[model samples]
Target: MPTILTVPGYQNSGPGHWQSLWEASLGGVKRVEMSSWEHPVKAAWVEALDEAIADCQEPPILVGHSLGCLAIVHWAEGHDREIRGALLAAPSDVERPDALAVLRPFGPIPRLRLAFPAIVAASSDDPFLSPARARILAADWGARFVDLGPCGHLNQASGHGPWPRGEALLSDLR
Candidate 1:
């Protein structure tokens, strides 16, 4: 079985977050730790993801949220290593003013097709990226898009704790 690499967004996923819950329950889930979660430097994050993938014994399933999704896309821009699939949820719009203040380094979102199978789950009312933009991004990345209605960022406050629906979505990746 392939390992599942959990990549959290800016500031990291808290204990009540779904990613954290999934890690606790899932057998082969490991987080791709960033050097600085508060101040994400694109190069550093991309390098960290690269190293994690390089260390994997087999191609891993990448589960990324928010800025983590951008990091995976950025990592895929350069690395061509084979992977099982990617499950991206609530991807943030780094180019937006609010996000740009922190995620400006990850700008120029890669509009290229992903090298592996991918599924993008997006919230309709997410303050970061509009649902339409999320759909466009999914199309650009050649990923299957799932519209999660009115779920704000799909974080804890969005009432997504232990989101079993998302777990099912991850299972669909294969």
Candidate 2:
């Protein structure tokens, strides 16, 4: 089985969050910890991800949420390491004027195509990103876009506990 690297966003997914829950319940899943989760630095976040990928014994599938999704995009721009795929859920648009100031560093999302197959799962009602932008992102990255209607952010606050559907999506990339 391919290793699954879970990358959390912003303040980090809580214990009740799907990402955290999946980590505990699933096998061969690693949480890529960020030292600056509260005050994320784009370069640092990418570096931590790089280390995790580099250390993996086999090519791992990346699973990211919100700003973590952006970090994965940024990391893909400069790295050529092989990976199974990516499942980017609710990718935050750091370029938005109302976005958190700390997240602006990850702005200007890369438009280049990714080397691996991937999927961008987004919500229609997510406050962090619009459906149009999410579609555009998936297109730019050459990944399939999945719009799940009005689910907010796909996080704990949006009440996505366990998120069995997400496992199905990940299974496709696997």
Candidate 3:
């Protein structure tokens, strides 16, 4: 069975975050611990993900939110890991000046085809990234895109504390 690695964005996924709830519900799900959650450095975050992928005995299926999704994409740009697939949610647009201030040294926008299958899920009204931008990113990475209607970043604040539908989507990959 493939290991499910949950990666959280800026400040990490707290108890209220859906990623935490999903991790609790799923078997063999683990969080890729970052060195610092409050102030995320791209290189450090990518290194942590690399180490986590290396430590896994089985192929990994990544489930990432917010900046975590960006980290996954950054890592995938050059890595050739045994990744079964990826479920990227709510990728914040670090390209914008306001967002870039937080995500210093943002990884290069990946144009290469990812080695594994991937899904990029975004909300229609996500404050971070627009649905069109998410679709474009998915296309650039050669992954499928799913536009979840008005699901604000799909986080606790967005009213998805226990997202059963998101879990069902993940099941399809398995």
Candidate 4:
């Protein structure tokens, strides 16, 4: 079975976040700890991801949220490594004015097609991206798109604690 790698957004997923709950519940799931979560540098995050993928005993299925989703695409673009799949949720638009302010280094979100089977999930009411934009992005990356309606950012404040549905989505990759 493939391992699961939990990749969190800018500030990292807090205790009540679904990613954290999934990690705690699932064995063989690991988090790819970035060098700096507060001040994200794309290259550094990509390198950390590369190292984590390299160290995996089996090719892992990446479970990424927000900026972490962006990082996964960046890593896939440069490396030839084959992962089992990716469950990318609520991807933040780094090109947006607000995100560009904090995520300057991750500008120019990759539009290249991913080498592995992947699914990109987006919420209808996510502050970071509209459902249309998310669908377009998923198309660009040749990934299956899932519309998770009205689930803002799909995070803790969105009342997604434990998020069994999201976990089921991850299981699809396996």
Candidate 5:
């Protein structure tokens, strides 16, 4: 089976975060460890993602949130690797001023078309990227867009600790 690499946003996904729970439950899931979660540098994060994909024994299915999703897109702009698929969740709108200070550098989303299949899951009520913006991203990346209704940020704060529905969506991609 291909590896599922879970990439968390800034500050990293904590214990109760759905990504962490999914990693614990899923057999072939691994967390892509970034150099610094406090202060994210785009180049560093992109490099780390490249390294993660390179290290995978099989083609990897990327699963990312917020800044992590941006990192994946940024990496895709430069390199096309052995990526089987991707699952992007709750991508932050770097264009928004209220987003984390570290995320500002990633403004004006990059233009990309993923070589492999991908799905972008966006919450209808997410504070970051609006549903329309998420749809645009999915279109640009040639990924399927899924609207997770009323799910705020789709994080622990949104009360989604397990996120079984997301897992099911990911399974469909496989």
Candidate 6:
């Protein structure tokens, strides 16, 4: 089985979130621990992510949500580690200043194509990032894009208690 590294967004995924649930249920699933969950520094996050990947015995598949997706992109932009793929869900727009003040620093997201394979799954009703922008991001990264209609943020509040489709997507990457 492929190592599934879950990279959670700002404030971190809570107990009820899909990422957390996957960690509990799946084997070889690990959560990337950021230095600070409530207060995120882009450099810190990127470094932490690198450390997490290094800890893995094999190249691990990255599963990022919201800001975590941006972290994976930034990490990939600088490093060329051999991994399975990335599953980017509800990628939050750090460029947008309206949401949270902490998310502003990770702005000016990298548009470079990822070295490894990746799949971007976005929701139509995600307030963090618009569907159009998500598609563009996927295109820029040269990853397959999936439009999941009206699933807000694809998080705990979005009601994805057990995201089976996301699991299937991860399986494809594996």
Over 1-174, each residue of candidate 5 has an lDDT whose tens digit, in order, gives 889999999889999998999899898999999999999988899999999999999899999998899999988888888788889999988987687777898766786788988899999999888899899989999999999889899888889899988899889877
Q: Give the per-residue lDDT digits (tens) of candidate 4, residues 53-113.
A: 9999888999999999999999998998879999999999988777657786787999999
Worst 10 residues of 4 by lDDT: 98-107
Predicted structure with the largest TM-score when compared to the true one: 2
lDDT of 6 at 74: 93
Model 4: lDDT equals 0.92
Better of 1 and 3 by TM-score: 1
Give candidate 2's error at residue 140 in angstroms.
Answer: 0.4
Q: Residue 43 error for model 2, in Å?
A: 0.6
- Model 6 spans with C-alpha error above 4 angstroms: none
Per-candidate TM vs. native?
Answer: 0.97, 0.98, 0.95, 0.97, 0.96, 0.97
- How displaced is residue 59 in candidate 2, in Å? 0.3
> What ranges in model 2 sit over 4 Å off?
none
Regarding TM-score, does 3 or 4 come out ahead? 4
In candidate 1, what residue range of length 10 has the lowest lDDT sum? 96-105
Steric clash pairs (candidate 3) = none
Could you give candidate 1's per-residue lDDT for residues 48-128 as a string of tens digits?
999999999999999999999999999999989898999999998988767667788799899999989999999889999
Model 6 compared with the native: what TM-score? Answer: 0.97
Off by over 4 Å in 3: none
Q: TM-score of predicted model 5?
A: 0.96
Query: Which scores greater on TM-score, model 2 or model 3?
Result: 2
